[model samples]
Target: MSARETFTDRWMTAMSHAHRLLLKASRGQLGATLGPMKVVELHTIGRRSGKMRSAMLSAPIVEDGRYILIASKGGDDRDPFWFSNLVANPDVELTVGGVTLLMRARVADAEEKAALWPRVTAAYGGYSRYQEKTARDIPVVICEPR
Candidate 1:
């Protein structure tokens, strides 16, 4: 990995750990939400390693019992590793508001993304900025109860 990628990975790992710690320490009273978005702990089987991996991510949009995730990776050129993992294994576990649920994940198709993009950007303008920063198209991931 390049130095910047390494740093980004390390920073993301550290933030996930800290977010989990906050949720645990607060007994789900705190850290359950980020601004208007809810925090979800997503667990997916690692694509190559076959081990379970977890990431703390904010769901910018949730509608019709589905959680929408943006694989922006802070606008990195490459998609997030967790996105790859889920693509390899669609079955996933999601913890939201201290409750865990089994969910299936998929990348939204072009039409879906086109429709959801506006809502996502409205929810968090940072996402628009993230997209502008990268050449690769950011993916919109949908997670629904399995």
Candidate 2:
């Protein structure tokens, strides 16, 4: 792993551990927060273990009854593990602001991403930076009520 990737992996691992603890303590009421952005917990079935796994994520765009997730992996070249899990099994559960719902996830096509990218970057400028730092086309995932 490159220095950047190593750093990000460690940071994200620590954050995920803390976030998991906080979610348990608060009944999913509280966790990571930043600049008015919405934080959510995504529940997915592990592809290899067939067990449930949870990851804390930021939802920069939630509109028209859908939630948007950016699979930037902290600008790393590879997608996040949660992204792979969701792709392997689209059935998911999302908890936002202490409210949980059953949802299905789909990766946005190029056209859909083209439309949403501007708004996503507008919501949080870091996304643009993330894109610049990575060679992969960061995926945009839409999660709608199931």
Candidate 3:
């Protein structure tokens, strides 16, 4: 059973739907870039409903054919729905710059997160502020091309 939506959840859902619509209308071109960061469309199977769900996320670091995503959720205490879905099913699809590819997602361990945290903060300083806003340990997810 789905939980009742709080005001924050409702707001987030509305914004996500709008972004998704824009992303789809442009064939993943327009909304693919957010300021200095590049955005990618992550497609995953819903953990409960078993349906495809897409989220636009910033890929602050891409190295060695791996795309790194931060599960900051704007620093919310709870993990994002997409993060949960990714954890349940690592295999997913990603559309970057209009090209879709199969990928495997995994949460970075504490050591790995520590190593990449600097790079992540450097890429976007706003993340640092987000970290300060919440007590939960934000996750760093690595998506490698399959």
Candidate 4:
């Protein structure tokens, strides 16, 4: 298989299995296998239709009691569509560590971004590579509990 195909296979196998486990149980055995990494659910409003939508995400850690999510889109050239949704509506609902909270998201200021970006990205290694793959700066949103 080609290198790209191999990468695609690995991604498919891991995500599909994880997704299945999530549907079956709120906290699955894989959570234990993956250390502090946990699946997060984000609820956002559609930018065009204003309809509500939810997506499952993998996060590394929570810092200072705040939730952080990167708009990586798995290193795609385009920012995730959800990113635009957040841009249109900063308020979001998120489930983290099995708890749900309403949060207001604001794109981090550059100074704050400089300090927090490294810490957040280091917590999840793939984030750095994702940033490298895209020309645009991947946004890191700080979601404060509301």
Please, what is the TM-score per model? 0.98, 0.87, 0.89, 0.77
Pairs in clash, predicted candidate 3: none
Across residues 76-105, which tens digit of lDDT does each residue of candidate 3 receive? Answer: 777889999999999999888778889999
Best model per TM-score: 1
Q: What is the lDDT of candidate 3?
A: 0.87
lDDT by residue (tens digit), candidate 2, 58-123: 888888889999999878888998999999999999987777899999999999999999999998
TM-score of 1: 0.98
lDDT ranking, best first: 1, 2, 3, 4
lDDT of every model, 2 decimals: 0.95, 0.89, 0.87, 0.72
Error of 3 at 77 (Å): 0.7
Can you rank all candidates by TM-score, best first?
1, 3, 2, 4
Name the weakest run of 10 consecutive residues (lDDT summed) in model 3.
1-10
Screening candidate 2 with a backbone cut-off below 3 angstroms (N, C-alpha, C), the clashing residue pairs are: none
47-142 in candidate 4: lDDT tens per residue?
999998666666555767677777777776666666789889989998655567899877878887788877767777788998888788888878
Using TM-score as the measure, name the better of candidate 1 and candidate 3.
Answer: 1
lDDT of 4 at 2: 77
- Show model 1 residue runs off by greater than 4 Å: none
At residue 23, candidate 4 shows an lDDT of 51
